[model samples]
Target chain A: MASITLDTVGKIYPGGTRAVGDVSIDIADGEFIVLVGPSGCGKSTLLRMIAGLESISEGTVRIGDRVVNDVEPADRDIAMVFQNYALYPHMSVRDNLAYGLKNRRTPRAEIDRRVAEAAVILQIGPYLDRKPRALSGGQRQRVAMGRAIVREPAAFLFDEPLSNLDAKLRVTMRLEIKELQRRLRTTSIYVTHDQLEAMTLADRLVVLNAGRIEQIGTPLEVYRKPASTFVAGFIGSPAMNLISRRAVPHLPVAAQAGTIGIRPEDLSVAPDGPIEMEVLAVEELGAQRLVHGQTGGERLTVAMPSDAPLSDRLRLSYRLGSLHLFHPETGRRID
Target chain B: MIENRPGLTLLAHLVLMAGVAIVALPVWVAFVASTHTATDFMSGTIPVWPGPHLVENYARMLDAGVSTSGTPPVGTMMLNSLVMALLIACGKIAISITSAFAIVYFRFPLRQLAFWCIFITLMLPVEVRIVPTFQVVADLGLLNSYAGLSIPLIASATATFLFRQVFLTIPDELTEAARIDGAGPMKFFRDILLPLSRTNIAALFVILFIYGWNQYLWPLLITTSSDYYTVVAGIKRMADAVDGLPQWHLVMATAMLAMLPPVAVVIGMQRLFVKGLVETEK
Candidate 1:
C-alpha cells in the first residue's frame, strides 16, 4: 500500500564490476511495475536492491516515506516471492503462510484468521495441511503468494516468480497475480526476462538494458513508442523489424535517418508498395502466419492473416506514420 | 542386472548367504560362548551350541562383572558408553551444522580460509594427535570424565563437510525468502535449516553413535579409573588380566552387551539413513 522511489540507485561489486547503475524509477502506490530485460540486464539485481536483499552501492530507496538504504531486508517490512517459489519444503501450506506473521509476533488467532483468509482467496483451502512437496507446481506458487500476502507487508517483491511454471501455467498464474494485486492493492515490483509476461502483467513496464534504464511507460505506451533501438526490438514479438537506412534507399527519409524500425503488424502486402521483398520462409502460427523474407539485403518479418495469398516476390508497405528512426552513432531514438 | 534367469537368481542368493555367514559367524560364536561356563572353554573345545547357564552367566556379568580385571560392573560400563556415544553424536552434529551454515551463508573476512582450516582437520584424527589432545584434556582437568571421552572426538570434519554439501544444495532463494519473512540468521537456522536436515541428522547420528561406541584406544588411554571406562575399553582390560586366565564367559557376556546399542541405532534409523544417502527433497 506504499509507493516506492528509487533515486539513481546503483550496484557496484567489490571486484569493480557494475551490475546496475543510475537506475531511477518511481512507482505509484499500489502499482504493478515490472522490470523487464534480457538475461544479465540487471533487472533482478535492481529488484534485489529494492527488496534490501542486495546492498545498494549508491542512491536512496524510499518505501513510503522511510529511506531503506541501510536497512536489513527483515526490517524493511517487505515480502518477496522468489523465482522458484522458495516455500519452506518441510512446512505445511498453513505453516508457510503463517511463518512471516508468527515471526512478526502476530497474535495466534490473527495468524490463523489470515492464513485461512489467504487459503480461501487463493483456492488453496484443501491443501492447508499438505507439505509443499506434495502440492503441484501451481499450488506451490499459490502458497508462495499466500506467504507474501499474509504478512500484510508494505510491498511485494517478485523475482520472476512465474518463470518456473510451465508455459500454460505461467499465463494462468500471470493473470492470477494481476487479479491478486488488484484485489489486495499491494504495491508490487516484479522482475522478468519474458517480454510477454512483462507486457501482460505489468501496470507499467520498466525496460532495462546493459545496467541502465532504456525506457519506462505503460505497456502500450512503451510498445507504441520505444525510446531506444533496444526497446524497439525487445518489447514486441516477431520483434519490430529494424533495418539499416541503406536497406530502403529509395525512401527520402532514409537519407537522414541511420535506422528505420517498423513493427511486424504494421506491414501489409500492396501492389503499389515501395519496398520489394523476396520470400525466404513463412511460419504458421494458428490464426496468423509470419512471413519472413529478404528485402534489399535486409531480413524482414511480417505478421499476416493465415488465409492471405502468398507469392515468391511481394511489395510491402507500412502503415502511415508507423516508422521509427534512430541515430547512426548512438542507438537512441530520433524524433 | 535386471534379468530374471532362475539359475542366476539362485547363484546370487547363494553368494549373499555365504557373505552373511562370513560376517555373522563370529557374532554367533560370541553369543554361544557367553552362554557357557568357564569350565567349558578350559576343556579345549569351544562349544558351538548354547549352554544351560545362559541366564546365570549374563546375570553375574551384569551384577558383579569380571572382578579380576578390577573393571566396573558391565551394567555401569554400558551406561558410561551410552553417555559418551550420545554426547559425541549430538555434539558433533550441533557444531558441524552451525559451522557449515556459517561457511555456506555468511560472507566474512577469510571465510574460505576458515572453511579450509576445518577441512584440513580431516587429515588429523585423534589417533594422529593423541598426545597433544591428551595433554590438553589433562591440562583442562577433563580426564577420567565423560567430556574427555567425547570432546576430543566431537570435532568431525566429515560431518561438517557432509552438512556443507547438504546446505549448498538448498537454493539461495530460500535464504532470501526467509530473510524477507523477518527471520534472522539464527531463527532461519532453527525454523528452516534444522527441519530440512532431519533425515541427514538421523543418518549421521547412526554412524557417529557406532563410531563413539567402538572407540577403544582413546577411552583406554584417558581413563585410569574404572568409573569412566567405556564398555569397549573395559572389555579389552577384562581380557588383559595379568594374574590368571581371563573370565571367558563373563567377558563374552560384556562383549554381547557392548554390541547391542549400536545395532539398535542402525536398525532404528535404517530408513532415514538410506533416504539421506539417496534422496534430497530440494
Candidate 2:
C-alpha cells in the first residue's frame, strides 16, 4: 500500500556514539525488505527508526508521499511485531486483536469483524478467549501477528519476531509470515541476525556492518555477486573463504590488491589442480561435506559431495569466473 | 526428600514450631483475658482458661461501649478505622502507581530531581514531621474528617519506590507495541500497565492497610470529635478513666476487635497474592 524511503538515515546517541550511519534504502510498494546483521550492527536500531520508535539523528523518512520525521508512532499508520511478541499479557486474544481498532475509534461491529478475520487467518480462533499466558510460545507469536494483521496498517515492521521460538517453529512461522505478507501485499521491513531467515523471507536483503550499509540485493543476486568482501563472507551458509592472493601460486593475478574470495561450494577436489592443501578436518553434513584445511598458511573450507573421495593431502580448484578479488586495504568487492 | 537429611528436617520443624508458638502466645493471652470478668484479673495469677463473660463483654463494648469515658461505641470506632484503612491503602496505590509511571516513562528537565524528592520523603515519615503536618491539616480545616485521618499519611515513598521497581522491570517493547497500536500514554496505563502490576498493588495494599489501621498518634492528634475516632486510638481514650481502674475486661474486648479487622485484611490480601502467583500460567 505504501513505499518507504529512508534517505540518508543515521542515528547518533547523546554521547556521540553512532548507532547507525548514513544509510538510504528505497523500498517499492508491497516489497518485503529485510535489514540484517550481527549483534550491535544497528539492524534493530534502523528498523526502530523506521517504526518511529527511535528518533532519527539525520535524514528524512517518507511513507507514501508524506515525510514522517516528526509524526508520532500512533499517527504513522504502521504496526510492529517485536521479538518477544509483546502481547498485552492480561487481555484475551480477541481483545488483543481488537486493541488497535478500538484505539482508532473504529465501530464495534468493524472491530469484531477484523478481530475474527485475523484470528482465523492466524489460525488462533480457538484461543480468542484465552490470555497470552495460557498460550504456548508459538501461539503467542501467532497472536502477535494477529494483533498486527487486525490493524491492516500501511506497513508491518517485524523485529526478529521468530527468534524467540524453537528452531522448527521459527521455520514454520517464517513461512506463515511470508505467506501472510504475500496475501496482504503490505510493505514490510523485517530485521534479523539470522542469514537464512533474511535470505528466504526478503525480496531484497540489506546487509549491515558497523552501522553502515554493506550491500543491498535480492537473495539469489546477493548470493551470486556480493557487493563487498563482508557480504561475500556473511550471506552464505558455510561462508565464503577469503585468502591472501600471495598464498596461492596464481597464474593470472587480477589486481595487485592481494585478496581472493571463493565460496565453499564453488571449490572442488581435482587431482591435477594447482592449489595444494593439507586437510585439517572434514564435516559430513549428510548431502555435502565441508572440507576445512590449510593451503600456504591460509585457512580455507571447501564444500564437496559427501560421497567424494577424501584424503589428508588434497588439491583444490575453482573457475576464474567464480573467484572474487578485493583490494586488501578496503573490504569492498573489486570483482 | 532433599538429600535424605532427616536430622536437618527434624531440626527445622522444631525451630518452626517454636517460632509459631512464640508469635501466637500474645494473641492467645489477649483472647483469654477478653473472655474473663474484672474479678478474674484481681485474682493475681492470670487465668489461662476462658471465663463466662466472653459474649457479654464484647457485646457491651460493641453496643454501649465505655459510656463513662465519653467516646463513641466501639462499632462506630471500628467503622471509622475501616474507612481510614481502606482510603489510605487505595489512595497510596493510586498516587504511587501514576507517579511511578510518569517518572519511568517521561523525560523532562528536573525529572531526576523530582524522583529524588519523592525518595527523600521515606526518611521524613509522618512521625518526623508530625507538628508541621498537623498544622497544615488544621489550616486546611481537615480536622475531624476522614481525609484528616488518612490523607496526611498516604503520600508514601516506599509504595512509590516499590511501584517504580515494578514498572522498570516491564520490557521497553511493551511501550513501543502500545504506541504502535495507537494507545496514548493514559490508555496504555489503564489498559496494560494496571493489569500487569496487580500483584504488586495487592501486596502493597496489604502492608499499607496495616500501617494505616495501626496509626495511633496521628489520628489521636487530628481528630477532636468522637465521630472521627479510629479503633486503635479510641481504645486508649476508653482506657483513660480519671479516678477508677480501667474496665480491664471491656478494654481487652475492644483491643481484640481493634486487632481482628487488620489481621483479617492481611490474611485476605495474602490469599489474593497467592491467587495471582498461581494464575500467572507462564
List of clashing residue pairs for candidate 1: none
lDDT, candidate 1, at B195: 89
lDDT of 2 at A108: 99
Clashes of each: 0, 0
Cα lDDT tens digits, model 2, A1-335, are 79999999999999999999999999999999999899999999998898899998999999999999899998888899999999888789898889888989999999998888987898999999998989999999999988988888899999999999999999998999999999999999999999999999999999999999999999999888888888888998999998988898563667655678889888888998878889999898999999999998999999999999999989878875888878888867775
What TM-score would every model get versus the actual structure?
0.97, 0.97
DockQ of each: 0.87, 0.75
- Candidate 1 per-residue lDDT, tens place, A1-335, comes to 79999999999999999999998999999999999999999999999998888999999999999999999998887889988899999998899999888889999999999998998899999999999999899999999999998988889999999878999999999999999999999999999999999999999999999899999999999999999889999998989999998989886574557899999999999999998999999999998999999988999999999998899998989899899999887888888
Stretch of 10 with least lDDT, candidate 1 chain A: A249-258
Per-residue lDDT of B34-100 in model 1, one digit per residue for the tens? 9999889779898989999899989998898878799989899999999999999999999999999
Model 2 residue B219 distance off true place after TM-score fit, in angstroms:
1.5
Fnat per model, in the order shown: 0.92, 0.87
